[model samples]
Structures are given as structure tokens and as C-alpha cells.
Target: MISWQARALNLFLKQTVKRSIENTKDVNKLRFQMRALDKFVFGTSSNIERSQSMREGTLCDEIKLKFSNSKKKLLYVHGGAFVFKTPAIHNNFIARLAEPLDLHAIVPDYPLAPEYPFPAALDSCYVIYKSLLDAGTLPEDIIIAGDSAGGNIALSLLLRARRNGLPMPNCCVLISPVADMTQSGLSSVENRYSDALFSLDVMLYCRNLYLEGANHDLHNEEISPLFADFTGLPPFMFHAGSTELMRDDSTRLAEFMQAHGVETHLQVWREMPHVFPLFEQLPESKAALQQIVDFIKKQQN
Candidate 1:
């Protein structure tokens, strides 16, 4: 059961995020909202330590990542559609993954579009992953995870790693990922009104800003790994809400992976919205977090 507090905050976020999308005129305004959440929604246990990591002379949002001191594990990518969101705004969400699994999450605040554009965000993630590997991070211990747009980035990074013959991660997690940036999936339109935070118009605008003259090769596996060969990669577990607009992304992706003989776990939380695990203090949210942690442990075995 979802706690009353979670329900209330979910309602509040639903209203505020939807209204923000409607009221905002451009991408910068969108960033303004994420920054505002830093003071509002992003505030969590500040007892955790945070640090920075830079690559190729560009400043990236690298956190000492308080998952667990277990072993340096997981190269996490934060989802923002290559447009908005930062570690501060997403602290409330990332802290859950950090504390439970004892993971060292290296979260990078990659450059966004309408400013950096196209391969910049994707390439930024690639550079961070490569830097981590070069810095002595074992590929076997690294599990990638992302939510919404971050999920897309994580999966794309995995595909890129495979293409470059980089060792595969132990596993990966996707929370309400936007795997297909084209937004051509049925859920993108079908649930346009079902999700509270995301809107079709704004998603399309972000896509245009990011794709900015890049190859529109929709069939490219890297563009949509759901369409690519996922064999011999890490095991994966995905959480997508039944009521969320991007539900079908996970549903279809799990099916494709299993058909290709990939081990995959897919959970559909009825009535839950996108990335509901951020509210881990809530009963249902805790359950989702437990599920994720269990999946990580299973990958270890």
C-alpha cells in the first residue's frame, strides 16, 4: 500500500510537474523547475558524502555515491532527456539505490541539448564510462541504471560499450525509461494524458533539440537497443508503472530480451506513476526498492 504521504506528494508532484510543463515556454524554464526541486523535492539525508569527478576537461556531476562501501560498483546515469535534471534535484531518488545496495554510484551531470546537442550527452556518458574503466573500475562489478531519460542513456551506453568491445556490466536497471527518444511508441501517445509529469509536446521538443541534425537512423540498434541484439549483455530488471505513460517501453523491452534468451525481470506496479521509488519512505516505494536490491544481489550470485 502507498503511504498517505506518498499519495499526497505524488499528487503534489503530478499537479506541479504538469503545470510546469504547460506554463514553461522553453528548455531553460524546464531547467528552472529541476533547480527549484533541488530545494523542494531533492532535499534528503545530507549526512551522505558527495564528491566531484571530471573528464576530458569538462566538469561532470560525479558523486562519491553513498550506495554502500561494499565494492566500487555501478556506473549510474541520471535521466533528464538530455535537457534537464541534476544530482541535487535527484538526490532524493539516488540515495535509495546508494544506501541499500552499498553501491558506489558515479553519476555524471552530462551536457544537455539546445546547448550541447546530439551525441554530446550520449558521448559524455561514454566518456565517463571509459574513464571509470580506465580508473580501475571493473566492468564485472559495474551495473548501470537510469530512470526516464536516464534509462535511455544507460541502455544506449551499454550498446555502445558492446559495440566497442568493452566488457559488459554485471546487470542494468531501468526505471520508467524513455528508451525510444523518437517517442514513436504507442504509449507515448496512448498515455500522453495518463502520466502527470510528462507531455507529448514537451517530449517532442526535447527530442528535436537533442537530435539536432544527427542521423535519424531509427533502425540503428544504438538508437533503440530494444530493437538491437541484447544477447550476452548483463542481466536486467526494469520497473515501470502500469499507469505510467511509458509503461509499454518496459513491457515490450522485457519481451524482446527474453525472446533473445536474455535474463530479464519486469515489474509493473498498478496505479504507480513514473519513478515512484524515489518516495521510498512510502510503503509501496520501499517494496520497489527491495525488488531492485534483490535483483542486484541476484546478479552478484
Candidate 2:
């Protein structure tokens, strides 16, 4: 059974949010709405200490620099079906990563649909990642992390980095990534009613907007990293809400990573939705945060 919070979330979805699911139809309006959310979501601080600034014309969320020990830099990507959300909207979420790891983080707003499209989001993120290397960040101090679409981006960035001979991050963490964009995964359909937040139709709609003309088949591995080659990734840790739609993405990806000789850890939180650890204001969210903090600490060793 879904929790009371989940039930209320679903009701909100059916009423107000369900309507916006159709935001795919008007890309401009969608961007406008996202801009409004960015005020609260993008520009929001990672709440960490460090020199901070915002850079735009890149991707979805404006870039943010959260200070830390100054030497260690963690790069973060925020997920919104590759359509909605920015760095600020995910500040509370990304900031938690900083809290546990005590590392500086750079989150760039990658490009989104219709206006920017697939290669747009992908390329923009790649650029910022490459910038880190150009700026002389050591491979060991760099950790890549993301939730949902950001998770997918994090994986994609790892693959691209490896393939291009850029130093792979020392580790990566994904929170409920969308690995099989084709939506062909059994969980994509089976877990539909399970996750309190995501709807398959809504995901399909967002996928449609992203891959509209490009790969019609999101399972192509470029859009979804499940089929991508992750042969030489760094150490990793991931968490998934058992009832969440993207749980399998984390599990399956972990299996693949381990199979490929990458040290990996996977945590499954029962009856929760995608990245519930991020909702730290709530009870479950607090417990979830502590677990992730522990995981990151382990990797620190």
C-alpha cells in the first residue's frame, strides 16, 4: 500500500500536475514554467561552503558552484525527464551530497527538449564535465552524481568520459536513474502503479519530447545507458525506493557495473519512490539521507 504522503502526491498529480504532463506540447511554455521553478530550484544553494556562481546558455539548470575543501569537486546533474527542473529545484537534493561527502560540487544546467533536445542536454553536460578537467581538477577528487534524469546523465557522462579518454570520476552515484529510455524494461511498466511520483505515460511524453525526431527508440543506449558500455567506470553507490518506477535501473546498472569489474553498492528502500532520500524534511527522507551519507563516507575511505 502507498503511504499517506504517496496517496496525497498521487492526488495532486491527478489534479494539477497531470494536466502539465502535457507540457510536452508547448516547449516554450514548458521552458517558461521551468524558469519559474528555477528561481526556487536552480539558484538555491547547495548550502555548502565554497565560491559559488551561475553560468547559463548551457543546459536545463543554471550552473552552481558549492564550496568545500576547495580541492575536492563533485559534479552533479539534476533530473527532470530531461525536460523540467534546474539546479536550484534540486539544491536541497544536491546539497545533501555535499553534506555527507564534505566535497565541493559543480552542478550545471544542461539543455532540455524541443529547444535543445537530446544531444543538446547530453553535449552540454559533456562540455561542463570536460571543463572540470580543463580547469585541472584531479580525477580522484571528482565524483559524479545525479538523481532521476540526472542519474541517467551521470552514467552517460561516465561512459562518454571513458570513451573519450577523459579521466573517469573516482566514483559515481545514481538515484533512480532511467537506464532504459525505450521504456521497454518490465519495471517501466510493472512498477508504474508502484512509484508515487512518476507515471509511465508522463515519462513516455517526456521521452517523446526529448527523442522526438532523433532515436524514436529511446532504448538506443545513448538516451538510456543500460545498453551502453560501462566496462571501466569508477567505484559507485546507488539507492532506489523499492516501489519506485526506476528501481530496476539502479539494480540492473549495479549488476552490470559489478559484472564489468566496477566496485558498486546498491541500497533498496522498500515502499518508497525515486530518490526519497532527497525529501529530507520528512521522516523517511531523513533516514534515507543518513544511509546515503554512510555510503558516501565508505567511498571516502
Candidate 3:
């Protein structure tokens, strides 16, 4: 059964956030509104400590437990349809993960869309990964993670790393990833109304802005890792709401990866909002966070 909190949050998002997304046409305006909303919802203070540092010339917010001695790292890419940077909610989510899992989390403030599209974000993430390896960080000690558009970057980064013969990370975690840019997934149509956070129009708008001047179409492997070869990718844990417009992005991609002999786990929460774990108020969010922590721990062993 879905928790009451989850149900109430869904309604709230549908009525407020989703409506705002649908009504806003300009990307800059939408970004500004989202920033303000994130601040309002998540607030500015957090228990976890955050510091700024540069990796491969990319500025990143490094998060971890105080006095942490761990060598493992989590490279988290924030999702904003590839147009916005890290928001308060994402910061809190990363903090939550880093605290329990004892990981040194590095979230790169990568370039966004319409200005620096396509290969720009992917290239920045790849360089950070390489920097980790160069600094004597073992591939087995690192885990790459992201949500929504950031998930696209995290997965595509692995695909690119594999092609270049770089050792894969310990594993990957994706929360409601926008894996398929083509938006051809069945849920994209069937869940048009059920999805509380995203509408079909908003998804297409973001996709168009991200792919604006790129030579590749929506089907490009880098743009849509769902269609790419997953031959030697690392184990993956995917979380998505059953009602999400991109539900099949996680489901289909997981099935494909499993078929390729990659260890893949996909969890679909009934009637949950997209990236529901980002909402700390929901009971289901706590359960999902525990599952993610367990998944990462298991990968380590």
C-alpha cells in the first residue's frame, strides 16, 4: 500500500509543481522558478558538511561524513533535464546517502543544455571519472550515481568509459533516469496523466533544448543510453515510480542490461512520484533509501 504521505505529495506535485512546469515555456524562467521552489521546500541548512573542489577543471561539491577516512567515492550527477545544476533536494539526498554509506560524494556542477549541450555534460563527467582513477582511486572503490537527466550522464559516462577500455566502477545507481531520449517508451504515453511530476510536453521540451544544435538525433547512443550496447557495464540498481512517464526507461534498460549479462536490479514503486526518494517526508522514501544503502553495501562485498 502506498503511504498517505506519498499520496498527498503526489497530489501536491500534480496540482502545483506539474502545473508550473506545463505553464512555463522559457527554460530560464522554469530554472529560476525551480531554484526558488527547491529553496523553499528543502531549505538551506544541512547536517552534512559540504566543500567545493575541482576535479579535471570541473567544480564539484564534495560531501561526506565529518572526519571520514574512506577511500571510496560516489560521483553524483544532478538532474535538471540537463539544464539546471544541483538543487537543495539533490544536495540533501546525496548527504543522506553519503552519511550512512560512508562515501566521499563528489557532485560535479556540469555544464547545462542549450548553451553547452550533448557531449559537453558527458565529457565533463568522464573527465572526473578519469581524474579519480588518476589519483590512485581504485575502480572497485568508486560507484557512480545520478537521478533523472543526471542518470543519463552517469550511464552514458560508463558506456563511454567502456568503449575507451577504462575499468568500470563498482556499480551504478539510477533514480528515475531519463534513459530514453526518443520518449518512445510505452509509459511515456500510457502514464501521461498518472505521472505527477513530469508531463509529456515538458519532457519533449527539455529534450529539444538539450539536443538543439547537436549533430546527433534523439537516437544517438550518447543521447539515449537505452539504445546503446551494455555489454560490459557495471552492475546497476534502478528505482522508478510505476506511474512515472519514464518508468520503462528504467525497466527496459535493466532488462536489456541483464540480457547482456550485466547484474541489474530494477524496483518500481506503486503510485510513487518521480524520484520519490528525494522527498524525505514520504515513508516510502525512507524504505527506498535503505534499499539503496543495502545495494551499495552488497556491491562492496
Measured by lDDT, the strongest candidate is 3
Clashes of each: 6, 13, 0
Tens-place lDDT digits, model 3, residues 217-289: 7777789999998998889999999999999999999999999999999999999988888888888988999
| TM-score of structure candidate 2 | 0.83
For candidate 3, what is the lDDT? Answer: 0.88
Candidate 3 residue pairs in clash (backbone atoms < 3 Å): none
- TM-score sort, best first: 3, 1, 2
User: In model 3, what lDDT does residue 48 have?
Assistant: 68
After superposition of all CA atoms, the RMSD between model 1 and the true structure is 2.5
Q: Which stretches of candidate 1 lie over 4 Å from their true place?
A: 1-3, 23-25, 42-47, 62-70, 213-215
Give the lowest summed-lDDT range of ten residues in model 3: 39-48
lDDT of candidate 1 over 1-301, digit per residue (tens): 6467666766776788767876355888888876775565535455455666667554654443444355656677777767887566465566666666667767777887878886777788887788778778787778888888788888888889888988888899899887765566788877877776677777777777777756678656555667878887778899987767788889888998898788999998866777777655457777888899999888887
Off by over 4 Å in 2: 1-69, 216-219
Q: What pairs collide in candidate 1? A: 67-98, 67-102, 67-103, 68-102, 68-103, 79-150
Choose 1 or 2, whichever is better by TM-score. 1
Better of 1 and 3 by TM-score: 3
Per-model TM-score, in order, reads: 0.89, 0.83, 0.96
